[model samples]
Target: MGQQGRSRTNGQGGPGAVDGFFEYARERQLIKLRRDAGESPPFTGDPVLRAYRFCNVFREDDRTTAWFRQNVRDVLRESPTEVTLATITFRWFNRIEVGEQILDILLEDGWNAKRIRSRLRNVQPLVTGAYMVKTPPGMSKLEGIIWCMKHINRRSLPQMPMTSLELAHQWLTQYPYLGDFMAYEVITDLRHTFQLQDATDIMTWANPGPGAARGCEWITGHKYNRHSKTDRVAMMNVMRELLRLANSDEAFLWPEDWPRWEMREVEHTLCEYDKYMRAVNGQSLKRRFDASHQGEERT
Candidate 1:
């Protein structure tokens, strides 16, 4: 934990020490949210998978059936790592549909770097979504795909090493467009799709993305200060305590389908909280997966 977290905990003391920042939330009775019953499938028994499930932010009013996301549920049975790397490479600064389309191109072209470049050379550029993606000048979307392919090829591995999820994050973020959030996302993907790491593994770590950070603040009334090591440690601590409370004898249980949460899942819960609030409250930035389309909003 950082100095900020330690100070806060020390001031509050005991169980409330970690949770005291959110006294306002408790006063407002914001902890318990009304979620739809059995909207999606129950989380698989796999601990890691359950954790990943908790990461996704689903809302009761969301248009669950509006879009068809074939790619999300599609698991690569063969050449998993190659496909995983290809998917992550194409995913950066792009929408889910766009990324899936790019992935199809790579797969059809046999993951051939030059062939893909040649085919996509004259391809029309696409504009979708609101955010600006920073890429090198003259780098077409196809070229971006190739850049990732080459990047992964140099490493000679499909997914990152499972030994240290944190280390894998460091390795992936060294790339041009891949940042901390994207890297953590890729790590989550590897765990969810290819079973690269266990959800309950002590070394496994999933940092909340921007959405999760905002959600944490809204729900807890505490700013999830991204730049502060103390804040980061505090965030993890609160998540741990909250999950324990949710399943404890005191009976703060969640929905049956909600499943027991792990650390990664707790990280996900915060992100989803951010998304739910944005949509319900009509924030300027609406959710990318706007219930009109089914997709993974987070990378």
Candidate 2:
């Protein structure tokens, strides 16, 4: 793990408010689903949702993730390790086009940090705002990243034993540049692609980041700890409970055409729900959505 990984989870909501949280997730998902079907602007009449940007209900539906599948994952499907390496490389930058450039360097016949630096030298702000990568003092972020990539490619990560999601997360986080948060993110992508079979068998394994922890807390009306292994397991239980409620609820009918929700997707949406609730409560948000951003999909 590098620099940004562990953090204290803090928030509380009424146990009775689970219904409200469910409603928000349901409506937010509906808006995205409708917009995807070629609907006009103002996807929702709810002012907060309309004005603010939130991630899609399913992580796979995110635009960059779609690009990842086509441009990176499929390109290297023969080797699971290569797919994982490209996935990490793509996600490290989080920009579809720019990620491809970096990935080319990664897949080159020779490993060269200088080449990586040259391609990204003039590129101001190489990373997307979705995730931040921090390096040690005096060492440039580019150099740190190159070193990290070299280690990942050369290490035995592909050969590592992954008996469960928690163990996969643990082994992956042991590498540089992969924090608690990013390890789970990469592993989720890997599992969704069916790379980590043994790990995905455990249905209740969803690692919580700070945002997901807040979301789980919001739904359960209790404090959730992202650090504790026990709490990580419990967090998914809350997700399952909410999912069960959604299946039985009359107000929110999940579209049959849509893919079934997975623990990973639910965990991701929970973070977006946390952001949505934050906006509803009048808290400041980092991203804004307006008419200019319409028709453009983002991850």
CA-lDDT, candidates in order: 0.47, 0.67
* Clashes per model (N, Cα, C within 3 A): 5, 0
What would the TM-score be for candidate 2 when compared with the true structure? 0.84
Candidate 2, which segments miss by more than 4 Å at Cα?
Answer: 1-16, 106-112, 153-155, 246-253, 291-299
Weakest ten-residue segment in model 2 by summed lDDT: 1-10
- RMSD vs true structure, all candidates: 9.5, 6.6
lDDT by residue for model 2 over 1-299, one digit each (tens)?
Answer: 11111011123465345656655666667777677788888777767677778777777767777777776666665566666776677666677657666667645422356776888877767776676765445777667777777777545756655567777778888777678777776777677544675564445667767888989877677788877878877887787766655554353545545566667766777887788767666798877786445323445
lDDT of 1 by residue, 171-206 (tens): 777787667766665565565444354434533355
Distance from true position, residue 279, model 1, in Å? 6.7
Error of 2 at 232 (Å): 3.2
